[model samples]
Target: MKQLGSKIRGFFNTRLGFFALAVALFWAKTYWAYQTKFNLGVSGKMQNLLLVLNPLPTTILLFGVALYISGRKSYITMLIIDALTSLWLFANVLYYREFSDFMTFSLIKGSSSVSSNLSTGVMGIMRASDWLVFVDVAILILLLAFHVIRMDTRPIKKLFAVGVTLLAGLMFGSNLSMAYHDRSGLLTRTFDNNYIVKYLGLNAYTVFDGVKTAQTSATKANAKASDMNSVLVYLKKNRIDPNAQYTGVAKGKNVFIIHLESFQQFLIDYKWDGQEVTPNLNKLFHESDTLSFDNFFHQVGQGKTSDAETMMENSLFGLPEGSAMSLLGTSNTFQAAPAIMDQQGYTTAALHGGVASFWNRDNAYKSWGYDYFFSKSYYQNIKNDFLGYGIKDKLFMRQAAGYIEQLPQPFYAKLITVTNHYPYPLDKKNQSIAKTDTGDKTVDGYVQTAHYLDQAIGEFMAWLKKTGLDKTSMIVFYGDHFGISANHKDAVAQLLGKDSFDDFDNAMFQRVPLMIHMDGLKGGINHTYGGEIDVLPTIMNLLGISNKGYIQFGSDLLAANRNQTVAFRNGDFVSPTYTKIGSNYYDTKTGEQLKKLTQAQKEAVDAMTNRVTTELSLSDRVVNRDLLRFYTPNGFTKVDKSDYSYTQSKALEMLQAADDKNKTSLIDKNNGKSTMNEYKTDAPEMAGLKEFADSYSSSSSSASSSSGTTSASSSSATSDSSDKDK
Candidate 1:
């Protein structure tokens, strides 16, 4: 029986069969459906898709080499590739918004592009069953890779198969364990793409419905049976009315929300040869009601700006453990600002300088309640230089002003700007002097473009003032994330004196500028540490709007009464609180803090986490059913301040302090103060940190020559930043 089985396997693993299959990939037409409903032209989507998948040639080369070397057929390898593609496709589509029509095999099977273009279903792979496709396909790929690769060597094949099967089993078992972990509530499954792909059998990069439905079901079930009320519930228990305290909301006013891409605190720190690069932003900070929360952090990094927007505008967070904004699944369940504002009877619109559907921002904006959406398509003519990502922030803001003017009575407009973005090159080739590289930019070019973008903002402010709209317009501007991640820390350290404060050395990514300007806003810099999550409640307070029993993670910044701002990551809190007077990040459950100077930050984060997760449990039911605006379902509960444990708090403190010490040490090392890491990762933070000492050392290109300072790049201004804007 064994001999016969071996013969059959050997027969199937011939070189000709392998070669035939390898050649077939070229013939197998992969039709990528138009991401946008409006057609660009023939082969437009295909060409763009190929460009997006630019590494394909390298991948094919690798496969070709592998086949030639190991005599492993490319066709056999394709089985693995196919499996992986399907798995990734499944994972990508797992989110409700991302999983459009072609995501389904039925839609893509016969078509040259995808199978379907449908964009309706659950929000994400919330349920546990969502992982099955990837896990199973991954298992098949490995089993087959070993089966084909070792067909010439029987013993090796057997051993490899066994080992792979065991590993897959272990991963599958661990995933099952996580799924069952009660503390994780309904989000304990393998929700992360990295985790699933690394351990599962095989994976495709496709976006399918991840384990979202199962998670929702389980969480809803858990919430239904729970006795605890989250902060929202607690707030309901002890509600406050802003109508009684402050004046009413700005009803007949125009609202401007500027979403700056990759705008982190480090940008200010990273100066262009000892000059504050962002003069306009610096000036705006002084003039605006700057709430400089010392310990504020982005809830979802660069990957989830929309999630941040959702949190900021609507006063809500997505599901506990996943990217609420990732366009993965079919169901459209985004946390939208315009939707809520629409509920308030406000004219709503979103403006950006990129394609409307790049991140499915248009679809997101549809339910987001934007009465109008102005994307790259709407622009009269865009400078399509090295349009790597999107367009200039200046153009976006300029267009946004026009949109705001078009709005009737009280309008809510979200304008996402791209300038001060990554590959922060300040040259003629990139961004038209919007400066792409954070380190060695052609300063004149960058400054010129930045000046232009800043002038745009200032000019808009001037316009508002001249039109008497300043009295009625509420402008909220903030950086989406850190720019380019180079020289930011050094710039900051140089300004603050790396030794000035131990806090700013590390986590420059978390450092962002947030300012709210309006006639009614009490102008002053509130240095209380906070993260992006705090913005929603802060806005609510400024607007004299109550928490609405929905937004629990945010705090009413206007309230003299105490409230905490919380944030989440990987289904748990890094530092949960933002209500503290000073900068510090702490875990509420373990009491293990990140920034230890203040205990208040940890408490606030913990309180916020408790509220957020508890709210999530309750929201599970309504999230799938309700529109984007009506998210925070009531009946949730927040733990009392006393409920926090001490040891957990202290541990977080120690970790944060240690982190601070380590970062300061690195900053010193980078600045010739101490020794540098022998092997540094080519990461944004490290690059930024490294630039502190060797600032602008990488500007060796003659075409991008440097004189007194780094010049702005000639590429699209804020293209990278605009991509992050929801």
Candidate 2:
């Protein structure tokens, strides 16, 4: 034991031994962060092994450089490198906590804009345990100072240093190979940063992001005005004329886009424990003035909610991998919905209960040309009023009424609800309904949160009617994406009463509710199939606006000859006649996989697939190449992102200034009195508040006055034609 201890001490005396120790500590800390701080979605034995192994190659490669230097300088250099790398990891930890995403080069480059507010956010999310990331560095410095570990002044052999680096390179190659084997196109086609960090290490992801950012920059740099010609030609050739019946149906009306987070179509009239899951939504879907579509799917990729927003606003698809809003929207030119509405003298605003930095919405919204953005900062005194993603739906709606009333009449307002997000959570006091018996906690809680969201929407609708906005405005409620992933297939199958879940079932499960409610409109559930990409063109048509010269990939859903094939981000598509999931084709009507296909069916599938591919590829090109910069559609002006700011004071100042000048704001029309008290919510946190106490109730009966809103089964359009493509 004495001899072994002496030998260990002797090894620690060498500079190489110190480098080895530093590498071990760095690797250990990274693995700890992976397991504890980040949710990399690690699964399976292979994935687990990869997660454990990924950090080593980068750590070795980075630390191995110090081994080439000689003496005490090498030791000092090693510590410096360790500190800097640890700082990077620490930064990501804080960043991930706020955005649930890793930091990118663009975010780092734009750090000057956020440096003032970064400290407060950093401190707020920081934990005592986070200091542990640097504990090893502190310990190593102390060891050297106290002479517990002596550093030898001998120089490392050049050959030995080269061999060490070569070893690291080989390790990284093997690591990447395994990652690619586990998930094809892990680097190229991923939408979530977690996937990259899960398969590769954080350092690797950073390097990959830098390379991608550079490539995107290069693509935009070489882009020319002529590049937009082919895009324009394709859109013009494929454009569908608006249907006469629906044209100008909502001209000059205020538009409210309600983004239902993680909501799915099956929940609209679904029963859980003998009770309607979304009773209010079910009622709204059947209202005479409501145009609902059960075939509407959310065509979001890895960007999820952000992807849906991008598509709905700009008629653009998100990047095949990573979020376009985060990666490109900040700098890329956009003729978004807000910009379009702004051109028509409409006040454009987006309200969310989450932080502005989540998905980089603050910068992206600016690029989108919104006049105002009411993020979490705008809604103050949020004492336990939040859940998984952001503020509770009821509370958010109640608070948003103040901001909404302040907006000018005929404004375009986007309200994002987050209470129904993943891992749906509800306090005991807020649980007005029972959880489902799906056995899966995620599935069970989804019903409760969805019901809660419906209740909130119901109350908000009542407030809208009370304020007379409902009579003049059009409300569009659409789900962002699927709530439950295929990971909980068994629970989903049990809830859906299916024998087994397959790719076809998963494809169909992507359906999300799309309901457009406007007064004086005779409406029914449209059998036409469409996705989020169709929203912008449909809105433009309804508003009596022509988007003829714009580079939109979607056509008006109300058009008689509109395309019915909805394409997903992953090259899969669904049409009225057939659905393609992975490499398999299925009959849309029968839900039967078509292993044997007739020549006609095969030809049809091939044509649809080609169209989907073309559309997605074109959208990708437009965004990646920043093609909008080269083309300005007729009657459209390029958006100046610098003209917008989302700070609380700035937003209020702009709103007040606009209202004073035009007298068109709803609050101005109402004689400048605050209408905050007019809004009500059943949120538990509002119970003690005297002003809202009278209006708050556990039951959602207040919003029942919307005619024909019943908790009955969905009303089918008996005579509606299913073939809209013709």
Candidate 3:
């Protein structure tokens, strides 16, 4: 036993042996991260084995630097290096627990604000098991302290160190070659950071992130104020005049923007198994009070849903590569919907079921000048009412009703639904639609969840009518993005009975439902080529607000001479005549390649392409350089982010509503009782759930009348009122 111990000690005390041990420790931590935190998406055995082995070369090269010194200096240098690396891994572990994403250099630079803005009571996210991440470091420290592993006096030769580093470099080069062969453009076109960590390990991803951050910073620094003049001139030149007939048609009305998650336009009147897939949406779409667009497309990029939001709110494009909300949202200045409406005496708020910090929305919304933001913390019943994203659509709508009622009149509110998101999971009891046997489970399950979302919308609409909010509000419903991805194109083609699907079909599938419903409007189905970027300008026109002074990239869709060219983030665009993608132009009318073009046609296409590219580039520059800070519109006031605190917003809202008793607020009208019970849905998650019954039990029944007069219990009324008030 003594002999064995002596041999072990001797092995650990040598410089080469210690280097090997450091490499092994790094490998262990990398493996731990892969197993516990990262969603590497490794499918095959070979990929899994490669991931396990990928970290070795990088680790050896990094730890090899410690061999330059001998004795305690070398040992201490290695320890410090390992400690920092472990901390980096640990930080990523914590961040991935909440975001399911890796950290970037930009995120690390802004970590101070990120840490401060973390939602209160974050201890729930930290698990006792997470502490295991540091156990290896602790063991190493203990071994050093107890003299079980001694610091050697011998130094590694410089020649040997250089040879090992060169060997590691060669090994890493081989690894990259293999990764590139397996996943083409593994380093170049990696829009998704997860791909980097999966293919090349986290250390490589961090280095890449740092390089990208430096490039972004340099770009921002090099951007000149004079460059914005051309962008401004282009925007002014392209601006369209609002239609004389429809301008100010719904002025001073409450606006309810319902963001439908992952809903496609095909689902509007689509039928499954001889039954209507979205009966209520179909009814609304056909109603004379609703204006429905059949050709509205969602022009989102890698940011997807968040990109759609960015365009709808700011009349700007999302970044070409990553999410603008995640990368530039905290720092960029935006002349968004909330701020624009706020200029017209509109009280603006955003209600979402998910965490506000998911896409850094808590901070972004503040920058956008939202009067209030009711996120997951504001919801009353979300314990078991959640799926992968957040609270289920039915419960989220039902819970949102009370808060919606509390907002003052002339309010601009947005409700973001999440039930119909990717990997659409639905409770078996709630699924009323029969699944199609398309042989693809994801495509098959999509119908059920979309059907469930429709039901939730139906219930929310009914509540609006019951509470009389429908009478004063212009409800704008838009599908955020496509539910089904391109991976399921074959199955979708089979389901849709298409002989063969092409890029044209894929582009057409990007169409999402956009409907504007109000009581007094003469609504009709309009076939106009518009995208999410056009929504803000269109709505502003209807609300008697002019967006002429703002740096809007999109024109009002309701304008007579509206630019119908919809530019996608990836340099692709769709016009009335042609769809151009990567030097190839397809005739929109016939869906065929344009083999030949007249001089006029060529000039027109070139002009459109230039406009699209310029618009995207200008938007990127504005965001990346925070140019809005230097260029505020005529009627706009810069938002003070310090004025908003998502933590105390509920109390502030209640107090404000109570103070404005004579004004139109749902709380005052409902006699300080919640209207959650007025919302009814066939969601399976609500089965036998009676938690909302006692929400407003403390309020006296005899305090106020049904006429919405101020009541005695109004002082004790809170945002968490019971659903039993009905």
lDDT scores of the candidates, listed in order: 0.43, 0.81, 0.76
lDDT (10s digit) by residue, model 1, range 653-683:
3323433333321222234221111222221
Candidate 3, residues 571-597: lDDT per residue as tens digits? 678977889854468889889988798
Q: Worst ten-residue run, lDDT, model 3?
A: 696-705
- Lowest lDDT sum, 10 consecutive residues, model 1, at 702-711
- TM-score to true structure, per model: 0.54, 0.73, 0.72
Strongest candidate by TM-score: 2
Candidates sorted on TM-score, descending: 2, 3, 1
* TM-score of candidate 1 to 2 decimals: 0.54
State the lDDT of candidate 2 residue by residue for 1-726, as single tens digits.
999999998998887788888888888889999999886657689899999999998888888888888878888888998999899999888777644568877566544434433343366468888888998899889989999999899888989999999999999999999999988888765545778899889999989989977887798889888888778788888888877788888999999999998899999889977899889999999998898998999998657788899999999998765678877778889999999999998999999877678788999999999998887666644357766566789988887776677677779999999888766778998898898787876578888889999999999999998889998898999999888876567889998999888778988999999999999987899999999999999888888888888888888888897889999887789999999875579999999989999999999999998888888878988998998988888899899988998765556666666766676766666665555556767677977777333332211122122221111001112101111111
Predict model 1's lDDT versus the native.
0.43
Off by over 4 Å in 2: 1-213, 596-602, 668-677, 691-726
Query: Judged by lDDT against the true structure, how good is candidate 2?
Result: 0.81
TM-score pick, better of 1 and 3: 3
